[model samples]
Target: MGYSRLNVVIRADASVHIGMGHRVRSEVLAEAFSEQGAEVCFVVHASCADFSKEGDFVFGSESEWHELAHQADILVLDHYGYDAAAINALFQLNPNLLVLDDNNNRGDFNCRWLLNPLSLRYSETVQFPLTGGQCAQLRPQFSKYRAVNPIGQQKLLLTFGGTDPLELTLPFIKSLFVKGFPTEFLLIMVGSGVQNAKEIQDYCRQHHMECQIGVNQVSELMAQSRFAISAAGGTLFELACMGVPTHFIQVADNQKDALAEHSALGWCSATDFTGCLPKQRVSLIDKVVESVLKTWQTDLTQRSQLARECVDGLGAWRVVETVLASRLVK
Candidate 1:
């Protein structure tokens, strides 16, 4: 926890418009940076936002172009809404800025380091019209904070979002119950920010589907599981890296492409939640859960390959090491 002082500022252009991957990955990156003794801060757009963090200097409202950049050795931008002008708005004040993007549109960025660690399939998404110094193309690195090598029962996690605001869990889990599948526990990680946690809990109890909401002990719970059924986003990467084989379901449109791609490669099975499922939602969940269970049991070989290729569990460390080793101040 002790090292050289590092003021790392991250820009995440997230809102109700964008889903939660950017902020989530940014937070994970910040946690990695913190492990190396960096003081991390995040600059978010001025909107009705609920995301929060400790030791995080939250900047917003007027979108203060604070001299925090001058203090920070690294200014990493993970936003999607911001184009060159938006990046320029911040970077003009601090010339030594590094941008981390996946969409591959860093057009004429004064970027010292341009990172796109996505796989070859995703390369097209990020292959910009222009070019710059490619950033650290990382091997998969699992999170140090998360559970490693399973020590307990299979932790089945169902995290749609920090806030599954739709109250979709009851119908979703009820569908699983109707299937009468053999499974130990189903952990439903929820954010209190979402108002439907209570409704989800009562429904879980009624159906005898073991469920727990609230964001406590998730990483540990996930580690204990032999397999996971989760949304295809940053969590998919984390689960694969942790060696927790997953039955991935895309809960959003953006996730569908990634899920399909990752599933095609045997990383995770794709059961999407983005379409109209008639009026019979429970029936659909049952069908999906059954499919997930079947694939999870018999598809170990593919899953193992997926675990290897997606993330070897060292990506966090590698990125941090790159950040530290690439320090210009030294």
Candidate 2:
């Protein structure tokens, strides 16, 4: 079952507003497809064209999407901007449509398959054979860097997605300092879309703390960190794969349900800070930092074990095998 003849076209986008989770996960699947000898191409929005590779396509209109779909053997869509009508139109162009979704909130999808790695719940109407965190698409680096003993250094990794649209990094770091958390142990990762990177870098320098902007080797950092304070997005699953105990925060409306679900599963702890007033936000941050310090003092063996048990770092391979095995691939 060589995939040398198959062509996989992935449609996703990233920007300062929407973040890079979609593009990152799409790349994970793309790598898996490439490993199987499939020809992979990315179709991103014009705003994110700068991030595209040599053979990638930048599409600005729905008609442009249809044009790409007409040529693809399998069109993998991971964008939130597409509506049910738009998805159905792509299905008309090519029936082998695989939609990567977070939630099944959209009325209905006429695609051949749907993959949602965050939630386990599946609608009776839709064909959601692939669900749950086991399907979480993570890069191969995470598996390679997975901590064997699940015990890490004293450093605490902090990431707020690729954009940090709410601008939570500096305020959160400041809150940690004000809450008596040691500044020397903080390892801040500033995303490419973070508008206040200069300010954050200056603050880190003044405090003599470490900060990295648009880092490529994130798995190396995660492998060395004892714990993390991350946004409730794809990074949570990545941390889980690395067996890092994390306290996650919801930064967007779409992340709310997934955060709650992951918390209930004991994969990670939650810190509710969204939609708070300025004064209340400060209070919540102080409380969360205090709680984090307390949790750090205790043994995190159970937390790490639970996280690793849920995400085994083979999700991308699982998804690739499923897609290649499907009847639609022909």
User: Which candidate gets the maximum lDDT versus the true structure?
Assistant: 2
* Candidate 1 lDDT tens digits, 1-330: 465576788877444446566776676667778878887888765473455454445556534646776667788877666687777766666655666665444465555555544542223322221221122222223355333555564656666655554445656566556665543566666655556778777877776666666654456666666677665656676666666777766666655545655667665676656675646556667777778667655635456545655655555566666656654642
lDDT of 2 by residue, 291-323 (tens): 888888988778877888878888899988987
TM-scores for the candidates: 0.77, 0.93
- Candidate 2 segments exceeding 4 Å error: 123-128, 277-280
RMSD of each: 4.9, 2.0
List where candidate 1 sits over 4 angstroms from the true fold.
Answer: 1-5, 13-20, 54-63, 105-108, 120-155, 183-185, 275-286, 296-302, 327-330
TM-score, prediction 2: 0.93
